[model samples]
Target: MGIFKKPPLRGGKRNAGVPDDLWTKCQCGELIHTLDLKQHAYVCAHCNHHFLLPGRDRIELLTDAGSFEEMDHGLYSANPLGFANYERKTADLREKTGLNDAVISGRATIDSFPVTLAVMDFKYFAGSMGSVVGEKITRAIETATREKRAVIIVSASSGARMQEGMLSLMQMAKTCGALSRHQEAALPYISILTHPTTGGVTASFATIGDINLAEPGCMIGFAGPRVIKETTHQDLPKGFQTAEFMVEHGLVDAIVDRTKMRTKLAELLSYLMPQPSLSGQETLG
Candidate 1:
């Protein structure tokens, strides 16, 4: 042998020069790997940036382990007008995202306090609200009322689903109607807005919550920035429609980072509906 080459020492250790495949640094200066970030509840470690979470992932993060009971799991979209490619698009999106629709609705507990949660997944056609989405959300609210549980909604969307045409636009009114019922029940409805909440979703149920919370740097508005600027011929303020701007303008209650969301929500729920004692009185009393 030619002095038996030991794989050139492999950079002094086995696999020593191989780059790690898991970890990545976000633009916000946060060091996170996939699994580690998931373990942190999809929050960036260094900057506490709230990563855009899937609807199901949000439920997993907020709900008590194994406590979530999905409502309306089988509901799906229908192409009433036989619009060309609409059905195929819906089917493809369902397969790609593994979601029945843009919204996921269910009943669960946060910190052991019963609540109903609905989250929108932007991956599902940019989270455009359609008839099925509106129906599912309304039904979820009804279920929560029957169970006497608080309702929480996490909104992340581009707008109404244009593919569904008028049916999609109808969701705006329907969802708002459902939220009105929640108000009538005196049940607290908390809305947490993520990045790019706009269009009919923002115009309706997204803003109807009793307490509105938004993630930092999230854009919450009914219209696109350019469209508004072009319409009014005025310069939009710096950070317009940002979470901080919403807070300053009294639109959003607070700007919460992802890391503290659970704790904050628990506190809010506690304040809204404190636990009852054995005598049917609040312990805080």
Candidate 2:
């Protein structure tokens, strides 16, 4: 009989399944490689840590499969002040991140509970809040209110955009105003703080959630640790403004891992907006 050669295995690259190159130790410590990090829902596998995710990814993770419908997709920024390099910067960021602005606003369902989602994309100019971002978010809030759906704002921003000057700063108040309206309507607004959520974004609606949640190990504060330390000339507290710290300080309602976030959010929404009790109505008779 002629010698029979073994056929190749059904699955190619057995070792490829292993994520050996999916982690790297950075000066800040071990950071998971981006692809592997994403697979783990932006959580660091090395330390069981959570990293900041882009706006698009956050929406995808939070929303039910194929349930998201984006709102305010036509918005774009114009060079009103003619700030130096502003146009170039915006174009560069858009090209790099494939996003028009720092924030993405949309409607989606979390475990069948309707919700409005606004997620900040740090990849776009460090997810800086500007007039456009503020407008989009405000529109989202209004839509949610009209639709009677809960609102979820996921923040991962550097701060206010400087190129827009005071205009960017005004966004702080504008976004807060929109969130305030939602509060007045007794609508639930949940803020999920991701890594490095700071500055105007943090000072405004990011911290204004009726129920605030944060990913594990996320930096949640108004300012960066370095700036604070330099300004105060003192050593900051251990774990400083991390999500764990915020939870301990009662700043955040819970420190949930990405894996559990969707389920937890859905449960919370259910409690806050339960279906009308037909059983109770029948019993009342």
Candidate 3:
């Protein structure tokens, strides 16, 4: 009935409800371009809010270009508890996240300072620690010890994976044991706690680092404020779980923004680990 049937709107059609890919809404109620946010290391320009970076993104952000050697790249969970639909869940996450497990362990260089790093991603099952995660982290730490390189763990987890039951709990001990050996070897270990680092992670290796760093506005604790308040039956102080509060209470050594993390880590590594030369190679301590 109409001329040319309205031309069919031409080339392509976009979903009406889909949001623009270039823009993102910050938690502080600010609209920002995704590329601009990334240029700022995903920190909100308006509110200085630190946005969550993917685990692999973090590795790229902190490491020197082309200097990451990943360990246990093919490792994955085995559904040890025979949890219902666990395999499906893991497979979905693996496909979705393109990661074998929640944590990515490897050797990397920050400002060309060699170190062993394990970064947790909340995108995969909230970055919960399972047997694979535990083994991978333990192996990373052991590698650092053998190579005499500093060990760094960036945690963004809801804690241990309950789907694996005791197998998951066992990781706490296993990771801590590896850290102990790393410690006895006199190698420095740094723990960087991002938002929502809690539960069995906080109980074990998360809290036992030689230097503990937390991100601004991040919540770091074993139990959440709600659970603590319900159990204690007392009004907790304001900013109870914030990184600033943790620093004030001596739980965290310092609160560093995400933008400054790589530089700060380099500085700390340079200070704690003085090298004979300016090379990025590992030293035998």
Which model scores highest in lDDT?
Answer: 3
Q: Across residues 120-216, which tens digit of lDDT does each residue of candidate 3 receive?
A: 9989999899999999999999999998789999999999899999999999999999999999988899999998899999899987889999999
Query: Residue 67: error of model 1 in Å?
Result: 1.2
lDDT of 1 at 60: 79
* Model 2 Cα shift for residue 273 (angstroms): 1.4
Model 3: colliding residue pairs = none
Question: Could you list the CA RMSD of all candidates, in the order they appear?
Answer: 6.7, 9.5, 4.8
Cα TM-score per model: 0.86, 0.84, 0.91
Model 1 misplacement above 4 A: 1-25, 29-31, 274-285
Selected candidate, larger TM-score, 1 vs 3: 3
lDDT of 1 by residue, 124-220 (tens): 9899998998898888887777667788999999999888889989988887887788778787899999988999999988887899999888999
Give the winner by TM-score. Answer: 3
Off by more than 4 A, model 3: 1-21, 276-285
For residue 9, give model 1's deviation from the true position in Å.
28
1-285: candidate 2 lDDT, tens digit per residue: 334666665757777877775665644587557677778787666677665576777878888998888988768777778998888888887788889898899988787777889888888888888889989989989888877788998888888888888888998998888888888888888998887899888898898888999887888888788889999999998999988888889989898888888989988998876553544223111
Better of 1 and 2 by lDDT: 1
